[model samples]
Target chain A: MSAELKKALYNISALADLGQAITSESVFHEKIQSVFYVITGTFLANRGAILSYDKSADRLITVTQKGFPPADLDRVDPEKLMSLGKNEPFLIGDSPVLAIAGVKILAPLWVRDEFIGVLLLSGKLTGSPYTQEDLELLNVIAHQIAIALNNHSLFMDLSDKLEENRRLYEEMRHIYHGTLQAFAAAIDAKDAYTQNHSYRVAKYSTAIARELGWNEHDIEGMYVAGYLHDVGKLAISNDLLNKVTPFTPEERAEIRKHSTTSHNITSKIKFPWQNVQDMVWHHHERLDGCGYPEALAQESLSDGVRILSLADSFDAMTSQRPYRKKMDVQTAITELKKCLESQFDNKIMLVFCKVLEKEIKGELPEPDILPYLDRDSDLSVISSMLEAIIQELSAP
Target chain B: MKTVQFSVTSRLVGDAAVIYPKGYLNNLSGESLVKECGIYIGKGITKIVVNFSETDLINSIGISLLLQIIEDLKNIKGTICCTNMSKFLQDTFEMLGLIQYMVVFPVESDALQYLKVGKV
Candidate 1:
């Protein structure tokens, strides 16, 4: 076989190398470095560099290079290269701006009208001048390199935009949570006895939902429902809400209207989570059809509504109220356990017990309910009570 | 045919470094050969013998890396000896005119013997 044919075969294989490098699953830097190696190997040039055009910065940044002074490559102007023939290899002929030590060939890379970058190569290691075939081969390699660089530029732009969108979404979510807290504060402020009542319900409901294996989105919805469950109490008079005496039948009937009122208020706005309105509206309904407005019986209730109902009553029982003193932690647990089949779902009760047990035993990383309970209460006693309840509920 | 993964292992015999490069010399993995030689070059050892018995195939990327090693040795005014090259490897090197830059031997022991008796 002739030496020229061998050289030709070598150049063709070099093109194959370029294609493999460009399409490989390797990271961007490694791929570029591989391509640079292919170029240097094909031409047998001891030195070369691949510079990419950073249009935003209007500079030619060196992507990868060897055997050249980096400062000299940094000084090569993108504007001057843009005026050269697109993707065509040319001999550097004493041009003032193109002058660099040992550089014999320069290819200004382009895809369509967009100038991508330039490829610089020093003389061959063999001391042989580049024949017409070498220049042609370089042209083909230069085109492939241009497309790779352009695709990379497009990808980088997309990545930057995606990062910006992610940041914006996080900020908006933070603001949304802040606004919800402010609304809960206003609702709790309507009556003096219920300070942070809405906040506790939100945390407790979130914990229960998490324990039930609800996903983050649904847990977030449960939290929102807990915060807004008493939003309708905002419409009730402060005198009636803070009244110390037992309510007359008419007054009790008026108080029952708040859940329906909560449904009415929440139904007006669009929420991202499913069943927000239904959960807030049906929170006061019971499993046995004996409770207030709508009186949604078992099976008619959703897990979300059941979760909110249990979380609300537990917080209310443990907290100080206008007409009644706050129940201690043990009494509150007993009250919840006694009311389970009548007002709450049995499964939800079990999960609540298990979570509380976990909290008391120091098993949970963040004990949502324990932090809000009365600080003077004996955790050991509460933990024992929870263990018994959990056993009873866990029995097949 | 399955391509062998490229690897480079080196040992010092007297003042020279004998680098054994195994597998198909094709892609960026071949950079290991250059790095192996560079370690000796950095240590002020003037002689490098690359035994290519296991490297049966070579590509442009491989050629580029070989050029880097040759250039590195030239810059240090040192010697490079290539031993146990396959026929294809020898012909490719000869056609590219790279044979003029480095001494070649039929086997690794011959190169080691030559380096032992030759001037530093």
Candidate 2:
């Protein structure tokens, strides 16, 4: 094989190596700077700098440099470099080097479509005119370097997109949870008897959902829904809702409609819980088809809805209601256990019981207690979370 | 200048309210609709009739806020009856799964008639 052929093969290998390393390396800047080092070291050049055009400042900035004073080379403005024709090798005389170093060969690092920057390999120790071979090698190296840089840009963009998606998802989740929490708070505020009921239910439901091996989304929905399940009771006449005496049959009919009313309220929302409206609407439903409104019974409701039904019942049973004192946790669980197939799904009930046990043990902060019906409800949870928000909005 | 006129009217039946809103529900004019509905809540009105007979364009945020208001009303045991929605709005609402929580009516009178509890 000819010497030229061997050298060509070696440069190709170098380019491949550079591409692979740039693609995989997580330490971004170091990998980029290393590309210049690879070029300078591989080509046996005396010095080199990778000059990238700054679109913003409308100048060139030395992204990575070697064999030049790192600080001074860093300060050199790219805009000062005059426009060299596509194929024109940047001459030492026409170059900005006239003001700086007594240069020898300056080559434009042309990538596929455009000139990326110039590779300044100053005054060869050999004092030779750069051969066609040297320029070709530089061109190949430049191509690989550009590819690496573009890849880096894309990686940064993808990372940014992923980050943005994550942030928006979290914000939406927060908004959803906040809305439920607000609704819960409003419910508690109105009655004053069920101060901590919604909070307890949210915690218990979240734990139950997690125990059932539900994903974060389902767990979050259950937590939020549990908190706001009783929000419909708010529409119940405060007079009728808070009345200690037994309700008249007409009032009983009004009370029976709260679930559907609550469902109706949530139905307007466009979240993942398209079914939650149904679940909330049907939470009071019995397995015997004796439940109000739709009278949906066993196997008619989804497991999630059933789980919510069990959770709502458990919370209501254990809460200190105006009409009834809070039942003990054990009694609440037993009551739920007895209601299996009649109201709560047996399998879900078992899991819910375990979840309730976990809540009593204090494993996590009560998950999103207040149901925020809107942005306003969400803001009110953090004890002056809204204050900071109002302050920011009110700021000049 | 193109004009998009949207109007919402509220009628109270027992404890519920019926809101008759006409015109577009997109981000541009959703604020006015929200403000109008908010007035009902402020007046201790829970039940609502949202008549979307002539409404158009419900963006994601607008839909979100509308849902929020519904949820708010739920906490208070109030119902919002959406009536006279266009076929386009109805399809979008169904696809978005809003039918689960909200009841829809073909006409304003049907919703008022169904939602009303007094005298048949």
Candidate 3:
């Protein structure tokens, strides 16, 4: 009803506008621009600037400004402003450090003990002196703006830390994969015939696990399990591992101890993915209770172990071994199909067949298994064989 | 209360520009009104008539935008005529002593007639 009441209501509405601008989902620059508009509009100041204190730079950088000489705003010392009271408006007298041409008021923005920024406003356009109420209103607006700026600063700090952490994690992961490759190479180096054997198994297991709808984390675990499954072979004597003759039961028993040794080696290290140890340990186990060491039967073995088991055997069959010549792609598929249900899970076999078929048909962008296979082999014959196997395995 | 988004439209009438501001005129969107006036001022038009018939509500932000237009016209030694103002708008301008900065009219035609006669 009265002019004072109307002006007060307008100030309250301006505060509401400030609140809306700060909380809006707009990006940082837009939100700061909106807030600048609210402040200038509320005070009817013809010239104004919102400056945020960059503590690192120890300078007052204008967030948004208008009608002021840009050079004058740039020269403002944040340290001098910090010496002023927090969130309190100080009339800009002809002080040496703050003697800007047209600025009539400065509110040093602070949250707690931290100096956040400053708000500058020229004389009102109406050519009237700012009342005590106007000063109080500016102080309130300054407080809100300080909080907003401080929140932005905090958010930026958190974002920077998160980005740094993400970069560090990526670096560590690169190094981690490198270390695993070196370990696999070391295991493969024990015997010339099994060169890159661990690498192929890792790829095959990863492809099968992916096709089986395992998440990326689990697929990574499967890959690691495949790579490290023969880590115990590092402990086995080189003569026993590369022996050209068929092993006696005594030597066969000695060779089987590598899986248990592999489990012992991996179990000491904590892996991000669950059951990596179990997957490496039980990779030699069979569903028909005929497997070595633990002899884990059906349901005792996890799908991860099943995948590693199948991948290991497939790579071993396709690769040249000292005891026997390598099987062709078709022969390997037949061997795998024949051994299914006895040693491997039907679901894992089906997924393996489907993935291999996809790789053979040139459907997968990066064929994990096909690259390591004998490239000179007839892919058409292998594709036909895989298609038949997929059909057979997919049948009820 | 539901707010209609603010918008500005303008047309050239003789030597003067007529700006129609619609909706609440209560936020940064109201800047378009100032921008519309600036366009005419840039073209060397000395007179602006803002018809506020559709703008039934305005806040301090709106007043600040009005002040910016008034200041712009003042700097150019030009005239700003506000017409078709609601009662609230008139009272607000009068209370803030802003009525003296510009002429007011009850209708758009009256402001156009005044500007036309003044052009003579």
Candidate 4:
């Protein structure tokens, strides 16, 4: 190859390398400085500087420099600088200033149809005239620099969009969680003695699910269901819910209607929680065909509902109530063992037993007692609770 | 960004109140149309004739507001019959599942004919 062609090929390869750097995740200022250094150091021995427009101030400002005092330009006012709009390129030594004695080339930076800035190359300190080849190369470099700047701007825009989407998803998730909590509270409020039952059920269900090697997503779904399983109880009469004596068969059937009620209630809300609705509907269902509502058999029910059913039964048996003195934790385990296939999913029952054993050993916090031992339906309390929760969520 | 404009006028037909509406149906016009329908509902005008002779555009917001009107009027056994609709608007109404609740007529007289027969 001819020497001139080889030199041209080398310059092309160097330019491509610079383009790659600008495209990479390198820091913004470093890329700008590298472009300034490469263009001025390789193309000429003259002092060089780059100026970009300050859109807010409507003036050109120096960005990067080579062989020039980088800080001195800062003290100069923008309006006093030579106008470099469009195709206008002003020479440095147009005045008789000593600093610009033999200055020569001035290349304006442009990309697309808009003029972004200019490239100012002054006289060579060793007394040299900038050749046509040098000017050509400098012009090409300035064009590439403009392209790089635009690319960086786009990257910044995409970065901002990603940040905005992340913030939106986070805020939506928070609102969803708060809504679920309020629904759980409403259910608890319906039955005075069952106030904190949902919270404990959620804790136990989440523990058993984690021990069973479920993924974090499934465990989270189970957590929501455990807290909201009795949501349908909102439709039941408060007197029926807190009855001091055992229910008649007809009253028992009326009580069982809450499962379907809860299902219908949850299905109306838009949430990524289909399993929560199923668990609420089927938590009373037995492995055998004796469960109320649809009486879904073991084979038809989801694994989540099966696990929740076991947790719900265990918690009810151990909890102290008007009808039955609290069963010993050991007795509850034995009862769970006796009715595994008949009333509960056997695998889930076994996990429940293990979780109970761990609890008895004090491996975790003692199960919380139910609240709302006293009843109050004053409008002020409910309104204040809702307002406090909403304020916490909307805080800056 | 499209503009939809319409007017609601009432005609006396036997013992029923017939309402006539015209204009494009988009975001800008859908709100006013819905509000006017509510006023008609207050006046005990349960039967309606919506004339679309001058309308050419309907967006999702317009369709949603029309659905709201249908739901609101359903409890009173009130009916809205759409007439003088262009072929394009008829197709759009069908695509949005609005035809199931509101009857469609090829011309104003056809809708009035149905009202005479109590078939609306």
Candidate 5:
């Protein structure tokens, strides 16, 4: 074979190898850097830089550079140099890009029909201008670089869309909580005395969690549990929830189902982090396992369930209801202590007591539990027993 | 958030159906409203007025439900408007672009009249 034919065949083989390498690469900077490496190595050029055109800003964006100062990249007019004929490699010192002293040639890069950018090449160590064969090889490689850049751009667009969708999904999950809150508000609308009761329960539970030094994530989880604890009441009627008269056996059974309903409702939310669904479901459970719905015992319950139980009891006791008036602070505290062994967790009640103490000492308008004592016919006995205990604890 | 007397009442004044939703308009209440409106629509009633005089609070979930009702009414080329909106809900309606599509009157009669004869 003729020497020219042999060199032509070798260039075609090298171009094919470099094309595979460029297309397989994903990172923009690294891919373009590889392009420059192949170009300079084949042509024996000491320095080279690739600049992709920014159609929006009408500027040449420097993608990669080797052995060249970046400062002069600003002075290189990529638009002016992009369409040069194959034989015309701009010489050194003619343009500001090659004017960087030792720099030599600038080859305009094209792909298909469009002008993509310019490839600036400096002098080889052998001290010779680019030969005809060298220029032909470099142009073919430039075509490969364009395909690589196009592939990289497409990959980036797809990646950005995926990220945007992920962000939207995260935002939608938060909005679901707001939707449930709205549902809670609608439920609250059924009665004036019970208004904001769930919100207050959540607030109280969060406070107790904070007092216990729980992490922010767990505190938020507790808040969700408290908020949804009474949500199952949505299935019952306003008449049933606010019935002044005592409920019949069937009505009472339906009313007692609210806790399980709340749990099921919260469970459907599917939160990304730790969920309070089970906690809300089990909020009505007692330590002695005499509570309603599933009647889960202490062993199956979590700290969140126990915390919600205390918070819900405190708010219900202190708040005014259709059948009962509000309870005084002292009386409510007594009731909470009395229920400790049967209804609530001691550890949770201890933290809640601190919250109550802060409000009492600060003279805050905490829920008035005094009227609740008047409504509960048997509360006076527990009240006196709690009062005696409080006096003993205060003696210290 | 609770309005004890919370209820959604419906009545017919000639060709226009008027719905008075009392209390907080959140998701649960919204579900009821959607069912009520769906009934009125199924009965071939189109022109409607939603009186919010008794409603004191509304949330995004409620707004989304309202959106559904509005979209359904619009599909039939039927007119629906609201009346007696609180100051906060008025702002909410404005921000959510609900005001541009539906006329909001400060009086129930005005909403009724607009729905009945297409006048503000």
Candidate 6:
């Protein structure tokens, strides 16, 4: 092969290597600085700088530089530079895109036939006009530089879009959280006696989870499960919910459907944690396959489900109800242990016992005086009154 | 203790409906609030001044419902202003970006002035 052909092959190989490294470099300043060194060294030039075109803004931005005056860099116009012939370097005296000193060669860079930037190289170290072969090598190098700049631009744009998406996701999450809190409050308002039941359940569930060494997300999932656990009861009658007497067989059947009902209501809301739905649905289920709705056994249950069950029971025992006396801390603790391995998960019960061990031993705060309704006299009378009111509202 | 029931009373003044809500504004109250606003919406009296002078103890549920009311009013190119908000409610509204889209007044007179002018 001819000497010219061999030199050109080596130059192309060197340019190919530079192309690979520049595409992967993350920081723009470092990337352009490295490419500027390569350009200056390849042409044996004294000074150089890259002027990258911002096509959208119709402006030029400084990519990198070596020995160029700041004023000259500011004065450079990328549009005018891009209009130059791809191969030809303009002499300082003859060039139209000048007022800068020491910059003797200007070459426009392109990739896939699209102009991307300009390489401004100063007078040669030997102080002579660049040879035809020097320009040839520079042309190949310029193409590689263009490819790198294009890749960098695309990478920057993608990063900006990703940041924008993250912000939007956070905004939507805030909205959903506020909405869910309102709905949870609505569930608590199902009856005057059950007020704040969801909030208390959520707190107790997370406390047990913390005692059991569950991760933050699992603990939070338990809280969400507790908050949304009783939403299904919305479809049941307020009279039934607030009735002080033990429900009859038919009434018990109506109440049993609430677990599944809650699951259905919360499923539409789409909680961040999927397992929360299972926890809500299976909270009433027992260990020996006697639980309602799903009748899920020990093996079918997640640890979170057990934690929720424990929290639900703990709050129910402590809460003041007009008909049934509230259980003391000692009685409640003993009751949980007595039914362990049958009605509740033993391990989760242990965790709850340990976490509340301090609070149980301390002063017992008086429970609130909840609005009381009896099924025998008050509820039936209230039911009729409520029915009358409903009829009145519905009437034209 | 059980929460008190929520109630809203509305009166017409010029072209606006001035609403006064009583009791704690939680989940139960939030529902009544929407229905109260709905009555005005139905009547085509879109200019509204919701006064909180008689109420306090609003929760997240109440705030969510209030956001809905504001959005409904905006859809009709109508203006709604809130009056007599405590410092806490004002801070909550500003933090949630609610103030960006609506004006909050320190008194009923200020709200009425804004509603009369229909812009802030």
What's the TM-score of chain B for every model shown?
Answer: 0.96, 0.80, 0.96, 0.80, 0.91, 0.88
Model 6: per-residue lDDT, tens digit, A244-317?
A: 88899999999999999988877777566769888888999889888888787679988888888887887788
lDDT of 6: 0.71
Q: Write the per-residue lDDT of candidate 4 for residues A1-396, one digit (tens) a residue.
A: 554564465456446545654665657776676565445434433356777756567666777664456555444344433345433344545543214323366666667766566666665433446556555666667677767766665677799999999999889878877887888888888777776678778877887787678998888889888888888888888888888999999899898898898889878866565577888888988889789699887788888888888778777876766667766554665677677678877667555545544443456565322121122333344334434433443356
Question: Cα RMSD for candidate 4?
Answer: 31.1
Q: Residue A60 error for model 1, in Å? A: 1.3
Residue-wise lDDT of candidate 5 within B74-106, one digit each (tens)?
A: 779888888888987786665434676688888
Candidate 2 Cα deviation (angstroms), residue A173: 3.8
What is the per-residue lDDT of model 5 for residues A1-396, given as tens digits with 9 covering 90 to 100? 554664455456456546644765345665565455556545545556787766667777788775677887867665566546632455656654435555677666555666667777777644656777776666666666766665665677799999999999879858966976887787678767788888878888888888789998788778777777788888888888888878899999998888888878777777654758778788888999999778887798888888888888888887888888888656777788888869888777766665544443444465332222235445445445444554554454
User: What is the C-alpha lDDT profile of model 2 across A112-219, one tens digit per residue?
Assistant: 555455556665433446667766666666566666655555677799999999999999878867777787898877776667667776676676678889888777
**Candidate 4 backbone overlaps, count:** 4
Off by over 4 Å in 6: A1-28, A85-93, A112-115, A207-220, A269-272, A328-330, A353-396, B1-120
Q: If you assessed candidate 1 against the hidden native complex, which CAPRI class would it receive?
A: high
Candidate 6 chain A: 10-residue stretch with minimal lDDT: A366-375
Interface RMSD, all candidates in order, equals 0.9, 27.5, 1.9, 29.8, 30.9, 31.1
lDDT per residue for candidate 6 within B34-89, as digits (tens), equals 78888988889888888988776554446546755776787798888888887666
Stretches of model 4 off by over 4 angstroms after superposition = A1-7, A23-37, A44-70, A73-127, A350-396, B1-120
For lDDT, the strongest prediction is 1
Give the lDDT of residue B78 in candidate 4: 86
Find the 10 residues in a row with the least total lDDT in model 5 chain A: A367-376
* DockQ of all models, two decimals each: 0.82, 0.00, 0.56, 0.00, 0.00, 0.00
TM-score of each: 0.96, 0.62, 0.96, 0.59, 0.49, 0.62
Model 2 vs truth, CA RMSD: 35.1
Cα RMSD of all models vs. native, in order, equals 1.9, 35.1, 1.8, 31.1, 30.8, 28.8
Q: State the lDDT of candidate 3 residue by residue for B11-34, as single tens digits.
A: 999998999999998777888999
lDDT of 1 by residue, B58-95 (tens): 98889999999999999999999999999999998998
